[model samples]
Every structure is written in structure tokens, then in C-alpha cells.
Target: MESKSYLPKDHVDILPCMAAFAVVVETGSFVEASVRIGVTASAVSKQITKLENILSLRLIERTTRSLKVNAEGEQIYEYCKLVLESSANIFRVKDKLVDNPQGLVRMGVPKSLYATCSKLIPGFLSAYRDVNVQLVCGERFDFVTDSIDVGIIVTEKPPEGMVARRLFDVDFVLCSSASYISKVGLIAHPSELAAHSCIPFVGDLDKQYWKFRSSHENCDVPIPGRYLSDCPEAALTATISGVGVSCLPVCLAIDALRSNQLIKILPDWIYKGALQGTAWMVYQPGHHVSKRIKVLVQYVMADLSRLSTTWKLM
Candidate 1:
């Protein structure tokens, strides 16, 4: 008997390459597609080639000018969309099984939180043994398509279309190493801060203009700093080294305050606002909340609640 030409083994399943194809079709460039998917452009091209070879048809008419999808490619794109949607549903159904929440849960967290909250993650993992958590930490927003399940952001306004659960309100305090403050003299008022060497957290300086309320009057003071860093940790390190005074979240400065490594300056003129910064748990609405996502969210909320009570600035 002659072997079948289109055997199951001979015809590779398209499921694996579906994601790549969808990204390429959407981005219209292999390089951009790779960036969105967090892979190299060559890898994307290879995946597309594999997909075309499996279907025995040219899907994309590649040229320097544009990446146009042929008729076959258009049909495949539609089918892939349906496949992905169906796959999402399958995952949703499977998620109902609490016995195991086995799958990747990509989470985005702030760098400062990682410094303080990284310790809590081990306990979360221990409790949810089946859930695989992938934590991505950064100072800036990393909100690419399908990249994260939950994002923890400290912002005044939440992004549109995403559910925002106010985890906690954060306050910033003007702090410095005891030696630094001693050398520069403590700032007694928001205006006095101009004389001190302030360290600014990059991208937040404009928003960080120190605000204080006194005797029913509000003060918004714009202070200059000689040092600036994108990472809060860097700012903290600089303060610790006696480089300058810095405004940092009370949560991040508590240990230093207790240890006398850093001293709170301008105690009377405390910066106060309605949680100048809020930590939010954001996720796309309408997407099925898998058991892993649910468990992770619950765990994080519980953890945040505990931290807020213990470390929240009054």
C-alpha cells in the first residue's frame, strides 16, 4: 500500500505558528512583529516560512515596500484568529479546574515594588503550587499586546478599557541620609527645598514637584535636583551615598528611616495629597479570568493589604 501523501505527520500543525502569523499580519513588518512577540526578526520569518511550507502555499508577498497578505494568507489569518479565540475559550474552561492552574501568568510590576514585594512572591508560589508566575519588572509601562495578565501601576489615572483595582495609596516623603541633611541643613518648608540638592526620579520630576498643605493653604513647590535616575533604587542608592535629598515612597524608605540610614526632612511640612500615587491592578476586561490569574490577583491583593497597613504613609 502506498503511503498517504498528506499524512498527519507530513502536514505540520499550524497551531504553533499561528501566533507568529497573527503578529506579522498585524505589524506589517517582521522586525516590528518580532519586537511585539519578544523574539528576533529571523525567528519570525522562520516561523512564517514553516507555516507556509505546511500549507503548501505562499501566504505573504514580501517586498521592501510592504508586507501584503495574499488571498491564501488572508484566509489563513481569519482561520488563525478563530483558532486563537477558540484556544482562549479552551483555556478558560480548563481554568475552572481549581485542582491545577498550570499555565504562564505574565505579570508586570514596578521596580520599587520588586525591591519590597519580591519577598512575598515565594509565599504566593508556595500557596499556588500549580500556577507558574512570570514577573517582569520595569520603571516604565510595558503594555504590549497579550504580554501581561496583570499590571501594577502607580499612576493618577488608570489606562482606559482596563479594570483598575486601587490596591493602595502611596505617599512620597523628602528624605536624605543623616549626613547629607546635616551637611545641607534640613528643609523646614517646601520653599526651603530649593537650596538642597534634590535627586529626581526620571520621568516623574514634573509630577514630583513637592506639594505641602499648611494651615488651610496649599503649597506646590518646584525644586531642582542635580541627580536624576530612571530607577527608584538608583535614587535610593544615591541618597544613601549622601549624594542629595530625594523624594521616595514611604514604603521604600521605611527601613532606611528606621535604621537611621536616611532621615525624614521637613517633618512639619509633610507632602500630603489623595494618594499622590496609587498602585493599581489592571487587566483587560472581558477576557476570561483564569484560575491562575484569579489566584494571583487574590494573593497580590492580600499581600498589598497587609503591606499597606504596615507601611502606608499617614
Candidate 2:
């Protein structure tokens, strides 16, 4: 098939405006496009208008209620996607010449990982002084369509169509404040948990059964709790205050365990099979991998490894 020709060489300077026009078409409004592109609505509108003028075509029919892309506009938008992507690749190539990894690296991580890694991220930025990192912390798996460069997720299986690298395996343990254990009595076995007041993670409680395995035996115990919360931090805080025993990621409960503020229950028993949680570093397979992304991934993997070891899960 013969390829359709684009505009004259002189029109190349309007590439940014053309890109903006494509975004507006896809988003159906200048305001939405502006939000996605991190630009003002007025600026996005002006750029789209400029592109329309350059092409001498009414690409979009705009009204107060809606914006519709014309046939020519749709074609241009399709071509512009390729053009903008190629242009971005050119800039990325040129950017690699700098000695330091420098650019914006947008990363998505689970809220729990964010809390633990917040302290370590600054060290990475210090090492690559030119790089600016944007960390979006959420529990939802929306990283792929959200344009996230890297996603740190805890899952048994990776999301479809993404490249996933195993970062680490996380272990969960039953933990309680030392004072609480001392006051209510120490829990030496899994069955003893039924008698203690427990703070269950509201999000996972419906899945209900907690499993444990020792050298010779395995058991899945039904868990009952007096309090429940969706936030891991809140649950940890409640456990720290001696409210109840909670099943927690060992990493998150480390400091309390070391200071004798929290005590682990049934140390011989393992939960959730061999893996309590699997941390996977995932990214879109064909997306551009900039130096900043490469460095950030390496740094995070190393940092998480160090943290995992410190938590005695190595």
C-alpha cells in the first residue's frame, strides 16, 4: 500500500501543536488534553487552532458541550501519534549523551512500598542529580494505561501483556505489640490466635482463612478480629498501640520487632504457601526505556533487596 503524504517540510515546526491537536482529538476536549499533557487548557486550544490553520482544515468541530474530530483530523491524529512518538525517541537518544541519567521518571508503586522506600529514593536522586522522579503511590493496578514507566506491584501473577521482573518474595507474620502479648498472654501456636483480639486488614479479610505451615504440618485457621482497616499503616499503628495481633508483612513490622515493641507469633509457622507476597517490577513491553528509567529500576531493585535482607527475609 502506498503511504499518504504528510504536510510540507516547512510545517515540521508545528509538530508540538500537531501533537497537542492529536491529544485533544483523542481526549475529546481541550481541558482533558491539557490535564493529560500538563499544559493549560487555553494553551492546548491555541495549539490545536494553530495546527488547524497550518493544515488549512477544520480538524475539529468544537462546541460548548462537545468536540468532534473530522475525518482529516482523525487521519492527522493517527499519523501524529507516530510522529510524536518518534520525536520523543529522538530526544531520548540525545538525552543519553549527558553523564548523569537526567529526565522525568514516573513510577507507580503500592502504598506499602512507597512508605518503606520514601526514605531510600532521595539517595537515588542524590546519585543522579539531574533526574527528577515522580512517584505515584496507589494499591490499584492502573499503571499500564496511566503512562507509568515502572510499577512495583505485589501479586502472584503479573498483569497481562507487560514485562515483569521478580523483585522479591515477601513473607507475612502474625505480630502484636510486646505489651499486648505480655498483658493478654503470649501466643505460642496458631490456634491460640482465636482467643486474642485481632486487627484484620479490611481489604483481605473476606478471603478470611489464614494459613500456616511448620516442618511436619500445615493448617488454615479461620481468623476473627475486633477491628479492621483498609490502610496497612493504620493497622500497623493499631498493632503498635497494643490493640490486637495483625498479620503483617515482616518488612513493615521490622522496627517494632527489633525494639521489642512488637512480637511475632508462631515463628515456626509459614503462611500463604512459600510466598506470602511476590513483588514484581512491571513495565509496558514496547514502551521507551530511557536511561532515567533504567537507573531508577536498578536502584530500586537494589534498595528493596537491602531492605528485604534487613527485615531478615533474605
Candidate 3:
């Protein structure tokens, strides 16, 4: 038996190992990839190392501060995405054969829509009991690279190479705590807003320019704020706490307005613009369209249409 030994001691399956490597590259960290795939960090590292050994190439550069995919790894990542997508399609194929929306649907949801999404989840699940959902939320998203089935985004234009269906045009209503408005006195016109303490929306710029529109006139006001933030919830909190007057989304401020926590200023003037911003359901049209994705999009469109009737959005 000792004399006849010529075979290798260890054998490895390439599929899962390759998948681990892909996830690592996609997430850009061994720890994050492990969390995504439900494995240990050591396991993710070993799999990528094993894949590198098999190929006889260093796909990624390992540093103490960062892990970067080299040129070769970038080329390999494209193929890896194809491989993983093909593997994912196997489930889609099965679902098609069975004529049922089953298995998992990975969706990217923006944090701003937490309230809307919470309302939609129960109804969607009840309609398709066999379909399972996994929602991924973050400050930023790249749907193509992250393997998201669909995404909800707020933008005037969709990301290049992705398809979009317009959900609604965002309308901003000027809101402030009743106390703030009472202290500052009434804002009879859009021009009067310039004199009051204004809480402007924070973007990449130092100053935020707010535009107001109507059938007869338009006004643009450039303003500054001490307590500036890019988050909607933060802006709403500051407004409700009587910090200053801010323009907030109608959907988000509906309950507050109804409860009299926040008072709407300039009742007839519209600050929301289609040219300024809009909400969309975006996805890669070239990718496989699973039954689950189709139904979810339909559900969202139908639900939002119903909700819009109450809030004056389309």
C-alpha cells in the first residue's frame, strides 16, 4: 500500500470555492463576504487562496489596510458574476417549471422608504406565501455588483445601463414645528422664507438651493444651516423640534402634518419638481427576470398607486 501511493491527498470542489472568492471581491472584505454567505472569515480567505493556488495567479492584493482586486481579478470578477448569476438562474428555472414564485428575492431598499416598505411587506408576503424576501438597506447601493434582484431609488435619472420604471414624483412641502412658525410669524409668500431661519437640505455642496414653483411664478432661494444633515429623518426631527423650517417629502410628513406636530408653510406653492427628483424601481433588464421579481414589481406599483390617491403623488 505504501509503495502504490501516487495520488494527491486533498481534492477540492471549485463551485462553492469560486463563489466564496466572488462574494469576497463583491463585498471587498473577507469578513463581510463571510457574513453575506453565512461562513467564517477564515473560511472565505482559505477558499480564495485555494482558488488562487489552482489558477497559479494572485488575483487580489492583500494589505493590512485594504484588499484590492488586481487587473487579473477584475477580469476574473466579470466571469465570476456570470457564473454566480448562472447558478442563481437554476432556481429561476425551477420556479418557471413549477409555475410558482418560490425561493428567495434579494431587494435593495433605500433607508428613506422604511415606512413605505414596512407597509408593503405584509401585503406582498400574504399574496405570495411561497416566495421569500431578503431586503438589503444602506446609505448607498450598486445593484449590478451587489447581486440585488431589484432596487428602489430616488433620482431624476436612473443609473447608466439599468432599466427604470418611474414610481412617483417627489413633492416637498415646507414644514416647521407649530412653535417655530408662531415665533417667526406667518410666511405669506415664498420670498418671505428667505428672512426666517431655514433648515436647507444638505447635499455635497455647502449651500442648498431650494426652488419653489407655481402656475404663475417661480422662486429659488439659496440658504445655509448650522445643523445640516443629508438624512430625511434628521431633517424631519430638527423641523419637529422647532429648529427651523425645512422642506420635507409629503409621504414622510403626512402623519406629522395630520397630528399638527409640523405645520405646512406656503400652502399653495409647490417645491417638488420632476426635474428636481423622482422615485423609481430600477433593475438590470439584461438579467434573468424571475417570477418573484415580476410579481413584486407589480405589487409595489399597485400599492403605491393606491397610496398616492390619499397623498397626491403619482
What's each prediction's clash count?
0, 0, 0
User: Pairing residues by index, what is the TM-score of model 1?
Assistant: 0.62
lDDT of 3 by residue, 147-208 (tens): 78888887877888778998876566788999997888888887777677787645323236
TM-score of each: 0.62, 0.64, 0.59
Screening candidate 3 with a backbone cut-off below 3 angstroms (N, C-alpha, C), the clashing residue pairs are none
* Candidate number that wins on TM-score, 1 or 3: 1
lDDT of 2 by residue, 160-268 (tens): 8888999877767778888897798867788777677887775553336677789998887777778877666788999999998888877778888888778877777
RMSD of each: 16.2, 14.7, 17.5
Ranking 1 against 3 by lDDT, winner: 1
Higher-TM-score candidate of 2 and 3: 2
Residue 161's C-alpha lDDT in candidate 2? 88
Global lDDT of each model?
0.79, 0.78, 0.77
**Per-residue error at 237 for model 3, in Å?**
2.9
